[model samples]
Target: MVTLKLLLAISTIKQWHTLQIDINNAFLNGDLNEEVYMSLPKGLTVSLSSCADPPLVCKLHKSIYGLKQSSRQWYTTLSDALLSAGFKQSQADYTLFTKGQDDQFIALLVYVDDIIIAGPNLKLLHQLQHSLHARFKLKALGTLKYFLGFEIARSERGLFISQRQYTINLLEDTGYLGSKPAKTPMDPKLKLDNIQGEPLADPSQYRRLIGRLLYLTLSRPDITYSVHTLSQFMSAPRTTHLQAVHHLLRFLKGSPGQGLLYSSTSSLHLRAFSDSDWAACPLTRRSTTGFCVFIGDCLISWRTKKQPTISKSSAEAEYRALAATASELTWLQYILADLHIHSSTPAFIYCDNLSAVHIANNPTFHERTKHIELDCHFIRDKIKAGSIRLIPVRSSLQLADAFTKALSSTSLNSHISKMTVHDIHRPS
Candidate 1:
């Protein structure tokens, strides 16, 4: 999904036309490499008149749906075909393939059977489509309206991607279609702990809900923090945790049509914001790291995860968060380079902690800082190489603050607005 969004954002910047293709019975196209046999079914038995004891098995020559290696085999076949067609596979993302150069370039992103082909030249895209169809049966979806449950709408302004139908179906499945809407996904004052409440009667239900919510975060960044918080309790969910999930569902009910808008007018510059909630986990006393990356004004990537190691100081936690953000920025830079878009200016990474900013720039390391030396060096290397610049921003203006912790309704809306997260169905 991160790669998909990045492609869409770059395509929007280039004003490229995107097309979709679905391979029919995509798995069956792969030729079997090893000799494999399958037992014949009860009704489909071979005649035994020609032999004393006829074999009740058949040798498989092609990949099938139930085969364990079907996906890998299909991918190998597809990769071979694309490689033969002059497309270079991306090291950053194996599923991505690119050909041509400059204005005549074409990019193809593969997700199992579904593919998205984007380029500025319509003739080249059609030629590629015909070529792919000749190799394997393909159903051209045409003009990239929907793929992988995301509904895409393009206009003169830009592209709008949403999961409106998916959200509605989820609400209906959970019996929350007519439920009252929630102003916020989670209560700002709530502190969820593992030891306080009794386990739910059915842990599987809580796990399933969390799984769906995690997918929902793909298009809804506002619920990311709440979903991350609720996901922690999936193993032994209590009534309180289930209630929190219910709250998130109600929040989704309020605006099921809300989604991301990728604007053509947005610039191509890269910037990111990093923040942390020091010792936020009640169970392990570990801090939570949150960061968001932007390509021009569009938010391309964001994450909220609890740190694996406990930091002794707030600066250590913030520094670790900055390191994570820097890693994502480095990968984004590589992706942009693959697209032939070079960043003339260094990416600006905003941090709320001044000590962390200093730690990234400072070469001196003490005994207390030795544990985080790896992270410090990684961030400093990027800084010294002029790939990124760490700047301290006021906590009030920190866009990643909402990702680290639950925020008040006012503050949450403020940050969402700044992130360009809006309901496309709302009146302009």
Candidate 2:
């Protein structure tokens, strides 16, 4: 998803043309490296001279859909073909391949059989598509309108990507289409625990619901926190958890068309916000870490997860959150460099905790910080190297605050707006 966002960002910046293609019988194109045999079909018309006494089965020479090794074999074949075409595969993302440099550059992103090709040169892009068609059976999709369930709309302003169809189907499947719309996905005062209610008779249903919701989060950042909270009870879901899921479904019913928008007018500057909810979990008392990264005004990446260990203080928890954010920023830097987009200014990281910022800038370790793991000190090195600078902001202005914990309806909407999440299909 990060690669997809970067590709869109670069395309928007350069006003490049984008195309999509689908491979027909993709798995069957792979040539088998090992000998494998299968039984003959129901009807056999082989000559007696060619058949053994017991009749010999058929040997397979090509890949098949059901074979466990089919995907690997297909990937190997595709990678070899691209490499032979003077395209270099990205070390950070093997699925991404690039050719040429600067304005002449073209990129191809592969997701199994579906591929997205984008570049500044239209003629070269079409020529490469023809080349790929010659090697394999390709179905040309003139423009990249839809891929992997995401409906993409491109205009002079920018690109709008949504999953309205997917969300509608999910709502219909879960029987929430006719339900009342919810103002908020989750109640701020609601508290969920492992043993709060009776165990569900069939936990698989709950698991399935959670799985579908997980995929919806790809484009809908508004439900990220609520979904993350409900996902924790997947192992042993209770009645309360099921109710919470229904509440989320109601929220989706209100605005199923919401999605992410990438503005062409936005700048290319990188900034991030890091935050944590100290001891948010009632069962394990583990802190939840949340961070969101933006390239200019567009939100590219975000995460919400629980801490691996218990923190003695809120500053420690915040510092750990900063470490995670720094790691993501470092990877983003590498990706931007690969895309030939360099930033002269250092990336800025915002946190509401002053102590955490002090800890990152401080050279000497205090007695209270002796037990801190060496891995948590990664942000310090990044700060010293001038790769990223940490700044303290007020808690109310923190965009990641909604990710770490449930917020009031007003606060949630405020953060959502700041993150640039809304329904582009709707009127202003």
lDDT of 2 by residue, 168-265 (tens): 99999989999999989899999999988999999999999999999888888788889999999999999999999999999999999998888888
What residue runs in model 2 are displaced by over 4 Å at the alpha carbon? 30-59
Q: What lDDT does each candidate get? A: 0.89, 0.88
lDDT of 2 at 210: 94
Ten residues in sequence with the least summed lDDT for candidate 1 = 30-39
- Cα lDDT tens digits, model 1, 1-428, are 88899999889978998999999763465533434434555577677897898766665556778888888888998899999999999898898999989778999999999999999999999999999998888899899998898999988888888899999999999999999999999999898988777889989999998898898899888899999999988888999888888998998999999988888999999999999998988899999999998899888899999998999999999999999999999998988887778978999999989989988898677676887757546998999899999988999999999889998889999998898787878788
Runs in model 1 deviating more than 4 A are 30-58, 373-376
Model 2 vs. true fold: TM: 0.93
Q: What is the C-alpha RMSD of each candidate to the true structure, in Å?
A: 3.7, 3.9
